[model samples]
Target: MELVFVPTPGMGHLLSAVEVSKLIIQRDRRISILILIIKVPMTSSILDSFVESQSRDNPYPTRLTFITLPPLSNCPDPSSFSFFQTLITLQKPLVKQAVTDRISKVGSPALAGFILDMFCTNIMEVADEFMVPSYIFFTSGASLLNFIFLFQKLEDDEGVDTVTKFNDPEIEFDVPGFVNQVNGKVVPVVFLEKEGGSSMIIDHARRFKKSNGIIVNTFTELESVGVEALFDQVSKNIIPAVYPVGPILELESKTRGGSQDESQDKILQWLDDQPSSSVVFLCFGSMGCFDADQVKEIANGLEKSGHRFLWSLRKPPPEGKVGMPTEHETFVDVLPDGFLERTAERGKMIGWAPQVSILSHQAVGGFVSHCGWNSTLESIWFGVPMATWPLYAEQQLNAFELVKELGLAVEIRMDYRRDWKTKKANFTVTAEEIENGVKKLMSLDEETKKKVREMSEKGKKALEEGGSSHMWLGRFIEDVFTNVASN
Candidate 1:
């Protein structure tokens, strides 16, 4: 049997899709997988390197293929959230051709299913054309997943548009997966808007109802309430089945798993020199960055806090471009004057970090992170406490869950949203806020840390043989066969 996977372009999104593809191939000898990669204007260093290295490590050469789709030249434009949506939409014909070409080969496995990334829901039409089951690989947490569904539900039942429903930013939404009331302002910015990517997101949420099911990148033990709530919806036939086959993390990050270079050695050495459970590690997601003013505030805060730290400070993208920041140095230009010199002994700012490796190290105690779901799961797996600092997309919603719903992280600012079109945060997080968040993060109570540690173990067990995710993986595979057979 064969499975076709379509993934979007962001590094995090694409990376998660790769990991899941590898996992499925490793688990099922009966299944051969082909991943259709959408070409875009961004970095594919991690994916390219992983695919190259797989030739040696992979036992099933014939069972796996990562084919980059033909480029979309119509736009000749840069990458942004909304632009990426348009980019994916324009590639529909390319996607159909890729799948058709593969299935028509002389001796290929039987076509079984299509695994679409959240943004690639539109490609389900191709699956419909082929008479195969389609599934969505949801890359974020389950609470946000539930909220997206509920947002659409409310709009339909209330006869109100998204923006008007979110008219009062102070109003709290009683979403099922969340124990705490989710504030309207803290909801994903996409959910509050009515056009562009927001429209696409909502349309995807509606499309989700027609798919075979949603395959989440999270484990049941770590998100019992949310997972259970999703199943409740299934019991009522409100949506398709929900499969929690995850905490599917890349345990060995690219740097640690692939090659060790000079930078890796230096990062490890610095941590090796620090006291156990003393250093605070800060990394925003791949797209995480701040303006000059916010960067100065962070520098001031770290200096005042006097904590041993490793900070990954990315320069913002060009003033108005919709893109991820490149590796930023020249700290003297944006950081508080003499701040680097004064904190030189206690803190270090580096380029992109080896996050999983650093979190697994004993010297690291806390994470001040952007609460990207992948980062959040990575922190939980390593038992590192976090102070949430959300940036974009559903990240603010993820931060709110970590602090308000899960109690797994300290609050830096739950409602912080980065405005991409304009070059500003909805509000600036001051140096005082950063300092205090750092202080609290380092001195987190043993109880909260203990809870995180417990969840970490559960997360591990969920992926082990006969565990929750393991069982779900099998179940999803079974459903793929069953649905295809029925069709």
Candidate 2:
């Protein structure tokens, strides 16, 4: 049997989905995966290279396949909700036709199900048309999933003015996955808005229930409270079966070929020269970038902190747009003059990073990150403590879980968002603020460090034969087969 995987076109989502597909095929030889690659604008910088590498490395290419769908001609050019909404709509008929061709071929493998990235839930319609079971592979933690379900319940079932209530700091939500009641303020700013990302998320959350299950990229041991909360009396009715089969991280670097390899060698060499546990590594997710003013503050912060560091600084998109940060030929334009020379011995700033490898390095002690779920899991996997500086998506919420709910990470600023139109932060994080966060992170207390180490060990064990995630993966496969047979 084979399963079709539909992942949102973002590099983070696509890579994680690809990793999970490899894991599933490793566990059960009965299954092969066909990843349906949807085209999104401006992702070729990394996406194309990663896909090429996967094709090159897969020993059994037939069992692990990738099918790129034809790009839509008039899909909005931006990488916003509207672009994705239109792309999915126009691509639906193509997706259906692809499925038709696949299962229709003579003596081909059985089409058991589809595993969709969270944002790609609207494509479940194609799964329904094929009479196949589909699962939503939530790339975030179980806590965020709980909140999404709770938000959907309030807006659709109970006639509450959800956005206004979410905005009110006094109105804390009772999310089953959280130990403490939380105001929606800490979540992605989009959730509080009436349209744009908020509408996309709510619409996706509603489609969530129509799927057979949710395969979250988290392990039960790492998120015990949040994973268990879904089965609580109140949530059971609203939530579908959840499989916490993860910490599905890429142990190997998905190197973008060409200069990427040379860059990695230099990065690893620099880390090797540093003293053990002495360097702080700062890398935001693929889309995370800051304006010139914010960039100066960070440079100032790093210089004042008096610690060895590795920073990945990207060129922010032009004002009045939201998009990926491009590589800067030199830091001279953004940095304070003589700043690079002054800090040359103690710090190194590059354009791209090999995060998993860096986290695993002996010289790396702490991560000052954007708190993307994939990055969070990688930090935990390597036992590196983090200081959260959230940029976009449900990152602020992840920051909250790490710092307050689980005590796994320190906070730079729990609530920070960049205004897309102006391409500047809603409010700047002064050099002093950045310095303080770095100090707290570098000199982090032993208690939090111990928790992170323990969790890291748990994350490792979860993919072992008898571990929680392993068992959950097995259960998910069985359920897919059962559901498909019944269908």
Candidate 3:
């Protein structure tokens, strides 16, 4: 049996898809996997390097095939195109052609089905034409999935304008499958008020229902309520068969690699010099960075907190771009004058740091993150508490879910939004707020630490034999074969 996986172009999405694909391959050596790479703007090199490394490490490299699609012609400005729009509108035809060509091959492997990222739902039409099953591989937690279904439910039942009118100082409203009222603020901003945003979400939900099932990158123990809620919603024909087959994380060995680069080694050595559980690891996601002013404020806050820190500082993006390559030389110039000199003894700032290795280190106790789901999982996997600083996309929602719903993170700024188009700043987190958030996360009470540790253990156990996540994955594979045979 062979499965084709299509993941959107973001690092987090690609990483999740890679981990899940590896899991699928490990389960059955006979089953081959093909990854159809969609070429998008921004950085292709990062995705290229990661894919190359994964292929090198796999024992059955021949079984894993990665095909990169030709770049889109006359591509729209990335700043104007929402990532979803770019994938669904621009690349759908190319994806269809690629899959069609692969299936038409004379001696090709039997194409069992397609596993698509939630954002890649547009490919389902091709799946139908080929008469193969399609499944969704959501990269985020179950809670967020549940919220997305609820968003569509509200739109269908109460009209689109009902959801579009949501504003700050969030009003609580009941959502099906959830025990408590979900705040409007906790919903992804795309669903709130952006033009075509709600429509895109609703369309994805509609297409998701057409898929065979969904595989989320979270474990039942970590999100049992949300998992149950998802199933309930599915039972009501809100979506599809839901499978919780994860906490599928990239292994530490892969992250550490065979040899470290010079900078990585230096960062590790600096971490070695710190006391156990004393340093905070601060990194926003790959796309996360702050302007010069925000950088200076963060420095002040870190200084005021008086904690040992490792900061991964990236240069701000170009005028219109959401994220850009970090220039190491500019980091010092952008920072406050003498800030580095004053904190030189206790703080280490680098252009980029090995996040997974640093999180796993004994010296790290807390994470100051952008609250991307991948980062959230990594922090939880390492049993490090968080100081949530959400930047864009569904991060704000993830931050709220972590701090308020899950009680796992300290909030730095929950309601913050930076306009991507106009580059107008909606809000800036002050040094004091950053300081308080760091102090709160680092000084977590015994109860909170114990709770996080327990969750961490539960995540580990879920991957073991007979565990919920393990069993769900097994069932998913069996179902795929069963469906194929029946068809």
Clashing pairs in 1: none
Candidate 1 residue-wise lDDT, 58-132, digit = tens: 667788887878777686455344676777778889988988898899898888989999889989989888989
TM-score of 1: 0.95
lDDT of 3 by residue, 1-487 (tens): 7898999887789878888887888887768888988876666767777777767777668777788888877676666546557655677778788877887898788889999898888888777878999999988888878777777767778675655466645587765545567676666677765566777877888778789999999988888778888887777876778989888776553542433466778988999999999998899877667777888899999999999999988766677655554634336678888988999999998876678888999999999998988888888888999888887778878887788778888888877765554445567789999899899888999999888888888888898898889899998998899889987
Q: TM-score of the candidate numbered 3?
A: 0.94
Model 1: ten consecutive residues of lowest lDDT: 252-261
lDDT of 2 by residue, 8-109 (tens): 888889888999999899988989999988876677546776787888998668799988887777778574547667777777887888878888999879
* lDDT (0 to 1) per candidate: 0.84, 0.84, 0.80
Report the Cα lDDT for candidate 2.
Answer: 0.84
Model 1, residue 203: displacement in angstroms?
0.6
| Best TM-score among the predictions, by candidate number | 2
Query: TM per model?
Result: 0.95, 0.96, 0.94
Candidate 1 local distance difference test against the native: 0.84
lDDT score for residue 179 of model 1: 84
Q: Give stretches of model 3 more than 4 Å off.
A: 82-84, 177-179, 253-260, 327-330, 420-423
Give the lowest summed-lDDT range of ten residues in model 2.
Answer: 323-332
Select the stronger candidate by lDDT from 1 and 2.
2
